[model samples]
Each structure stands twice: as structure tokens, then as C-alpha cells.
Target: MDKSNFRFDDKVVLVTGSAGGIGKTIATAFGKAGARVAICDINRVAAETCLKELRESGIEAMYFAVDLSKKGEPQRMVSDVVDAFGKLDILINNARAGERLELLEDTEENWDITMSVGLKASYFATQKAIPIMDSQGGGNIVNISSVSAHVISSGSAAYHVSKSGLSQLTKYLAVHAGPKNIRVNSVSPGLIVQDEHRNRFKSSDNVNYRTRAEQCHPLKRVGYSQEVADAALFLCSKAASFITGQEIIVDGGLIIQDQWALLSNKTHTTDNI
Candidate 1:
């Protein structure tokens, strides 16, 4: 397909949690596609590094260091992006924070932190960006969700709940924003291991972690941040102009396999019966 269909020549895109990992990859993709990118994250140093990389690549980019977990911060971040870029064309809510705690073990503070950044931030950011987008006649919003929303994972109760809420929030916002020419959607990723994660598991004990993880997926490999970024870009591009209120799952078909199928090393043949 032609790459121009995905180009964002004069558009302004705001991506939260873009200091590193999938968020940074999304911002980088947008910057490469000609969009004026805004990188938002709690980590000032990492955000600055991403900002420098984008600028060095001849992409118009800025960085915002804000705690999305705090009330009013999401709105303030939107305001800052608009002030810097003159307009907001696309908003990617990709920042999230979570604690490793089961349902009974989860603390109120941890739950609040998870929901604040994962769900509440997306809601308020969309609320603040609506008017700006409406003024421009239209815009796009892509919430970064996770497979945890649909499939349960051990010790991730709060994170899963927040992601589920985010998915539903996408649908809700799409319904309200459709008439205003604004599109809302979500991209759910599974088992994406980025550079940081690789570093964390570099020891001999976990040297084969990636390989083992790949075996869980039908594709026989784990996903990359760029793959998720591509999905986000497509959802916001002209190619998906008619698409809204939906979710694109970028999981290498991990969620679709049956338990037995995932466990088996060999393919089954009906003729064997």
C-alpha cells in the first residue's frame, strides 16, 4: 500500500508515557509520518531523550513531564500540547502504572495509582482534547489497552480492571465524539518485550525467556513495540477514516488459541482418527 495514506503532514499528535517502550515507539512512528509529536511521561530524563531523538531525526517534537495520576494534570498536559503545537489532531493515551498485587492483596493506594494513570487520565485527556479537536473539525484518539482486559493474568487485578475500563471508555467516547468528527479507538497488545524488558531479563536464568514467550503465541515469536505502533498509526490514518469505536488486537494470535492447542507441540490431524 502507499505510505502517503498514513502520512500526518501537518498534524499534531500527543502520546503519553512516550519516554520509552511501546509509547516511545508510537511517538517515533508518528514523528516519522510527518506529525508534530508531543511526548508526555513522568520521567523527565527519558522524555527528554526521546524528544532529542525525534528532533535529531528532523521531526517536530516536544516533551512534557507530568504525573498523569494527579487530578487536572491530564487536562493541563493537553493544554500545554495545544499551546505548543497550535492544535491537537491525535491523542494516544499510552501511559500506565501498576503494582504486582492480587485482588485480596491489592492496596487502595496501588489501585488508585493504576486507575489514575490507566483509566482516569485517558478520560480527562479525551475530555480536554474534544473541544480543541472540534474546533479543527475532527480528530483521533487511540487508547493503548492490553490483552489483560480480556484475559485474566495472575497478580494484575488492578491493571486488568483499568484496561477493561479503558476499552469500554473507547467505545463510549466514540459514540459521543462521532458526530463531532472525532474518532475514538483502542489497540490492545500482548507480550510485547521492549529493550528495557530485555535488559531486565538478560541474566542466564532468563536467557531463554523470549524464546519461551514466543512459544505461547501462534506466530512463534513475541511482538515488538513497532508492531503495536503500526497498528495505532493505521487506526489514526486516513485508511481508517470510517473506523471508530473498535479495538485492534496486536497479540500475534495468542488469545485465540485453545488451551490444548497452546500446550501441544505438534499439530493435530483429523485423519488420524
Candidate 2:
């Protein structure tokens, strides 16, 4: 099956924002399946922790502390990966910046930080990795965009714009890299129950925001990092070889449903990927 083909055996992957949530899950999956992964993040502690977990499971992993929002950080990180593994077969750009429901009031400082980390980082990171991939004759790049890229609400304006830019970046890379046999795609997850989101409501009396968000989704629930991870594995794997410049929506199918349907627990689940 396509799943099996996506096996990362002997492949070298570099995952950014891999400290927790979907990033960590994706890294673990690759590690479990046998891949040399360079786990990167702004927080070295978290990155090391993730690496330790992977090492405990016997996955060949490395950790690096890099601030993705910095201008040249992407290029530098790519260099680190190549130096560590001598080859980079996959690049997963999953680092994001946002605070839900705080877009309109967002400061310029916050906007720059969000956009740089979420969008620009992806661009330069992929740019740096492309040459390496070309030298190897081919490779894969899977970007972690979000449904927010398309369906925007009154929250995290920069986050939304950044993700939208990311989708376009994915398309551009796909078209440009096709000639070199490298495939580029993106995975857009819906409101998933990740640690960051959970942490947001830690002090709230009603700490069930995830549940509520999930309920609002057409699928009757939010998604897991693992689900999005699975989607990334698919796009990066040979299973989606013929697919490029395409984004796989990993949400609970929320984009299509109307507001009433979403609030009422009605869902449409006939999507066949």
C-alpha cells in the first residue's frame, strides 16, 4: 500500500519546530520507520527531549537549536542537516507562529515574528534545501500549512496570511522542482488538539477548548498531531509522487460545512484521498 511505500528507511529528514505536537509526532513516525532525522527548534531543551524520546526508541536522531524567525536561520539549519547526515532527503516545515483570536489587536512586532517564523522561514529553508536535493537528483518537501490559510476568521491575522503564503510557496516549489524530479506539497490541518493550543487554556476554568473546537469542526472533533503526521508521511512518500503543488486538508473536513452544520454536530466525511 501507499503507507508502506512512505517508509523512511535510510532516508534523512529535517523537521523544524519539532519540539512538540504534530512536529514531534511526525519526527517520531519517521524515526520509528527508520530515518536519520535532524530535529530542529528554537527551544533546544524541547528539541533534545524529543530526540531523547526518539533515541529511547532507537531512532537515529540529532537536535539543533535554531530560531526559525531569523533571516538566515533557515539556510544555516539546512547546512547543519547536510553536515550531520551528508544528505537530506526530506524537509518538513511545520514551525508556526500565532495566538488564536488575537489577530486584530496584534502588534507589528508580533506580526513580524509570526510571519517570519511561519512563512519566510519555510521559503528560505526550502530554497537552501533545493540545491542539495537537486544534487541528489531528487527529493521531497512537505510543508505544514493550515486550514486557516484558506478559511480565515477574526483570529491570528498574520498566522492566516503566513499560512496562505505557505500554500502558494508549496505550489511554486512543486512547479519549479518538478523539472528536477523533486516533489513539493503541503498538509493543512484543522483545529487540532495540540499542546500549544492546550496550554492556552491551562488557566481557564473551562479547559475544554479543544473539545469545543473539535465539536465545531464538521468531523465532530478536533484532530491529533499523529493524523497530520500521517498526512505528511503520505505527501513526502512515493505514494504522492504524481501529486505536487497540492495541499491535503487534514482537518475534520471543516472547510466545506456551513456555520450551522458545524455548530450542530453535522459532518460530511466522503473525502477520498
Candidate 3:
């Protein structure tokens, strides 16, 4: 693994929902890799803060505040980034409406919010970026999907369905966009703890969610935002030049386990072999 392989010099990257959490980390990671990053989020304040931090770290960055859930906002966002940066080399569709509701209990507004930001926005943004990328020779896109798409949870109906659609969208775009030299793919993360939630999830309480989550993973631990970012960087780099329309699952090996075996092996240990 040559360290120079990850270098993204002269590239311009736009990351959606990059105010805080995983999106912020991904934006920063790209900046560190020598890419000029555009941090876009609905929250103006947080986005500004993130922009300051990136500039302070000597990473060339700018900020764009727009709600992707609104009509035409995604297209406008892509246009805005290109306007500022001259060209768009990479697009990371990391924004999503975080709502938790079951199908029976869900409202139309809630469902629409989730679908709008998670799936629709990504689609439109890519639509806008495709032509620009084709004109510039080529580009890359990484949809920030979730493991929820494959494994369902009780109260995450909209989230699951939206992610499922995103994965399918990735495939659809890959086939159509490939002829233009633009690559599209997705990274589905599982049980990732963002910076703000790390302290709370790490608490050593009687009912420990982290401990329980660790058992479900073969790696015996939950994942961090940086680990997921690394996977994304790889897919966008020349290392994955021949890859497209694929998904790299960063789930600590959770989705691959046999349900029956996991149930039987309740007691878990992480001793170094």
C-alpha cells in the first residue's frame, strides 16, 4: 500500500451533509488527501464551523448551506460547488433525513423527508454532476448508503427503503454513466459511531449498547467514521479504476454472519490470538 496512492491532488470534492458526524469526517479526510473540498449542509452554523476547522488545518475548503430535501436544491448544490471550484471531480452523497418510524406509525411527511434527502437528492445531484464530469473527461461518486438497506430494523422503514433505493440507483447510474467515463458506487456502513455520539455509546453502564454491538461484529468492536472514510477514498482513487456499480460494505463483518450461529455463540471474547 503506497501512501502516495491516496493522494488526490488538484481534485475538487463536494460532500453533502458535511457539517458534523460522518459527513464532516469524510470532508476532512478528502481535504487531507490534497483535494479542495466543498462542505455542504443544511445547518449553516455547523457548516461554517467545519469550514473554519478545515481552513485552519490548511486544507482548501468552502461551505455551502442548502437543504437537500427541498425541490431543486440538490441540483442547485451541485451547480454551486462547480461554480466555486471550477470543476467537480468527486461527489459524496452523504446527506440524509434521519427519522425513526415504523411503517404503520409513519406519516407521509416523515417518509417523504427521508426519501427526499436520502435517495432523491442523491439522484438529482448526480444527474447534475454527470454532464459536468463528462465534459471534464471523468469523475467519481460515492453514495453513503447504510447496512439498514440489507438488514432491516423495526422502526427504520423509511431509512431501509431509501438506502435500498440508493444502492439500486448506484447500479443504474454506473451502467449509464460508465460510457461517459464517470464512475458511480456506494459505501454501506454498519454501526458507525460519530464523534458526538462516541462518549455516550462508550459508557460502561448495565445496559451497554456498545458491548452488545461489539458481539454482533466479528471484529468484536463497532466502527468509527474514519474507517468508513478510508473505504470511500479507495473507491474514488485510481486503485478502483476498473470498479463501478459495486458496493463496499464497511460493517465489521456483521452482515456475513449466520443468524443461527450468532444466536448460539452468545458469549464472545476478543483475546488476541
**Which run of 10 residues does model 1 get worst, by summed lDDT?**
264-273
> Could you tell me the lDDT of residue 138 within candidate 3?
98
Model 3, position 231, has a per-residue lDDT of: 90
Q: lDDT tens digits, residues 4-33, model 1?
A: 889999999999999999999999999999
Scored by Cα lDDT, where does model 1 land? 0.91
Each prediction's whole-model lDDT (CA): 0.91, 0.85, 0.92
Cα lDDT tens digits for candidate 3, 100-179 = 98777888889899999999999999999999999999999999999988998777688899999999999999999999
Candidate 3 positional error at 159, Å: 0.9
Candidate 1: list runs displaced more than 4 Å: 196-205, 263-273
Instruction: Write the residue-wise lDDT of candidate 2 on 1-273 in tens digits.
Output: 655786889899999999888899998888887788889999877787888889998999999889998879999999998998999999999997656548457788888888999999999999999989999999999999989898877777888889999999999999999998899999999877675565564447655865567656666776888889889988888777798899999988678777775457554544522
Ranking by TM-score: 3, 1, 2
Better of 1 and 2 by TM-score: 1
Better of 2 and 3 by lDDT: 3
What are the clashing pairs of model 3? Answer: none
Better of 1 and 3 by TM-score: 3
